[model samples]
Target: MADTWTAIDFETANQDRGSACAVGLVRVVDGRPVERHSTLIRPPDPVRHFSHHNVAVHGITAADVAHAPAWDAVWRRILDFADGGALVAHNAPFDMGVVRRACAHTGLGHPAIDYACTLALSRRTWRALADHRLPTVCAHIGHRVTRHHRADADAEAAARIMIAAMSEHGTTSLAELSRAAGLRLGRLDAVTAPTPVAAPSPVGPAADRFDHWRRAAETPMPQACPDADPSGPLFGRTVCLSGDLAAMDKPEAWRRVAEAGGHPARNVTRTTDVLVVGSHAGVGKTAKHRRAETYRERGQRIDIITEAELLSRLGMTGA
Candidate 1:
């Protein structure tokens, strides 16, 4: 853990000590990655004794882990991962279990680390995003992960995504992410509970909050796009936005992607995952994408998103 979020990807073996298996770590600080590491470990316990299907998912077999150190041997170094800063994993409950259980099994000294789930962050960032899976989210944001589901690769991808999501969401605090994302906070289960606030001395009739929100809700949303769902055809891929969009302003449109749990690209290249084109998406640019064959040659996808579509996704509808 560093000044920024540290994402951990751990591959388990048959639902056991797979606790300290191969892990990917990405340390983000000052909105950039200062360090990254990927390594495989042999936990002291036979927790990661692999089964056929598990081997298929991560391509790690019992033979592969036969010589690696057990959890007891690796506990100290693993603890160091959470030493400097906050940790992040896709669904932290599952990952945190590996950490906690490993600690118990090995009697390792645990660090006072704070960890958050990127999965929860994505949900709170955008309600209608198709899926929170790392690969899918990466595609929707137009980021390519060389290895899929492998602990280290997945963790690094999550770190990039966490950064992009925060930028897209205009959010700074983990508390805000927990509130919007699926990360449960203040349960007093995982961590200690906070003290209760002092009671108010006296109170009168409350202000009409319902009336105020009702008035605001009644106001028409801006009509930037026609109503269309289109099944999006973006369900299981990474997507990115490049350049000045013709359909909407950069900030607003990028915000829409994050709300959808996607990424925004300032430029399009051969590696560009998806280019959401707008009105100003003119001939030269189109030709360049074609000439470079960014989509065809590189297998990059191009999705034409109309202005109306963008607005609709934002829940804006002005009469």
Candidate 2:
């Protein structure tokens, strides 16, 4: 078990994993972060357009990195920062995909570096949790994550999460922890390695019924709201909704958004200015949610709030 590794996170400009716009790297030695690096890079042309949803997620914009280096120019620095140590990330596949695809797209050779996922580790470490999302796992382990989408902050959080897991399992090295969890640490170099997928746990009929209900609750239907206030607080804003709204149906919700002078959008895109995520929104992995998250990662000013919060902004108490 090596005590040193580099934990990394990448924020993409769009759905293409190779379209990385920003990266955060944290170097941990002896289970402590000793160095860190973060930077923004322009995605390749022809696919360089950043989606509104992704911009809302990370807050990065084309203008911000207009003069910044592109991936080809930036990859060397990332390699130097890793210094040949193993790499780690919350979701290793996404980040590694960015690295691999970016290299492939740019005609650059992939660097041979081993990587591990704290996400997979978290599942084994905190099996009782309802889900193993980064924020959820971070909160479960009492790690402070001030910024969720920023590559730097996310990388640091991932490092802390892994370190905490190591401590809990009495494993001094990532290799040992991977062995204990019956998981494999991923690698990238001569050949791409597949990320280990955790096997599904068996659930009884009652569990199946609950899951059905849960899935239904997550897939909210879009509603059309009319007679919006053109001069309202949400005026000029493009709003999208996800998850189940207990207070109102989709039509009523859309109506309220329109009434508030906002454009109600059925899909999340680069143009969306706000996303109202309702409770039980099983949309953490949805394409729409991911797009919104990408926008948030770039430091774009997209308001992502709960349904109640959106209603409060619209000066309403309920449907």
Candidate 3:
């Protein structure tokens, strides 16, 4: 609760974090909303396409933002409106990620700001609630968000939620509210576009060791479990594995697939029906992953999913 702060919400055109198609902001002064601002943005070239899922969520189509200002232009206005004040958002990480990633793509300097998450605050203050989603929290505190996905309405709702949380905790400032709720105010440090770096080639013994490790990581195909549940999601599906799964190794993953009545293959062949890709951030796609995509492009009905999705389908999420 610095005398002034901005509450923000961003709608992305696609899954990419930098694809900010619209933004809503509400500025609060002395615990009261003083200004409301919103704009539709044309996402940068690299991630400008609107996905059907995203459109369904926010109801903002490509036609809606065809003539809108680009991210850099809107970002400047956002900074001007904030006037160096802290930011508050329902989920600060997502909105702030949009800021950082969009800035990186455009080579614009990232904003250095302190921020608070009304969502986190609500979770801590109203721990008894079944869920701490924005709409749920707002409804709990009697703040009606008539337009759920609209940027302006969401920003306003977040602002009001923060105000209510402050009152609930009997705290006059952000610091006080954070301490009372046993949470910490998050910060966004100043950042700029990163320089590309080429990976160094391993030499001599290191290269040999790397090759050995790579070969050792590739697990042999497991035989399908004859007694596995036939009604399972993976039943009768030919599943392939790729990348490093968080919970288990490749052998465990293949075994689980077999346990679910799936035929686990060592590679993505013509018969492969599903490719379970694991978490491999900041790395190039694995050979199996690329093969699956190629087959899909050629009209193969291949399902590409993540490790979490695989576990969920197998009814072993926490396993």
lDDT (CA) per prediction: 0.54, 0.72, 0.76
Worst 10 residues of 2 by lDDT: 196-205
lDDT digits (tens) for residues 1-319 of candidate 2: 4478999999877555667899999999888899999989898663476766468778998898898799878888888888888889875755886787777666677657888877667766787875556777788989877888899999998999989988998888888888887676776666344333221111222335455345434544533223222323476688988765654445446655654457788788888899888755453466667789898898767887877677555543322
Best to worst by lDDT, what's the order?
A: 3, 2, 1
Cα lDDT, model 2, residue 266: 76
Worst 10-residue lDDT window, candidate 1: 196-205
The model with the greater lDDT, 1 or 3, is 3
lDDT for model 3, please. Answer: 0.76
Q: For this target, which candidate reaches the highest TM-score against the unseen true structure?
A: 3
Candidate 3, 202-226: lDDT as tens digits: 2222246455335435546767755
Error of 2 at 91 (Å): 1.2
Instruction: Residues 1-319, candidate 1: write the lDDT tens digits.
Output: 2246577877766434324567777777755777777766675353444444346668876677778767664555555654556777765545665666556545554546677766555655655765556666677777898888688788887887777776776656555555445444311034223232111111112425354335334433322111112132332223444334333334434534443344444455555455554543345555434443445654545554545444443332210
How much does each candidate deviate from the true structure in C-alpha RMSD?
19.9, 17.4, 14.5
For model 2, what is the C-alpha lDDT against the true structure?
0.72
Judged by whole-model lDDT over C-alpha atoms, candidate 1 comes out at 0.54
Q: How far is candidate 2 from the true structure (C-alpha RMSD, Å)?
A: 17.4
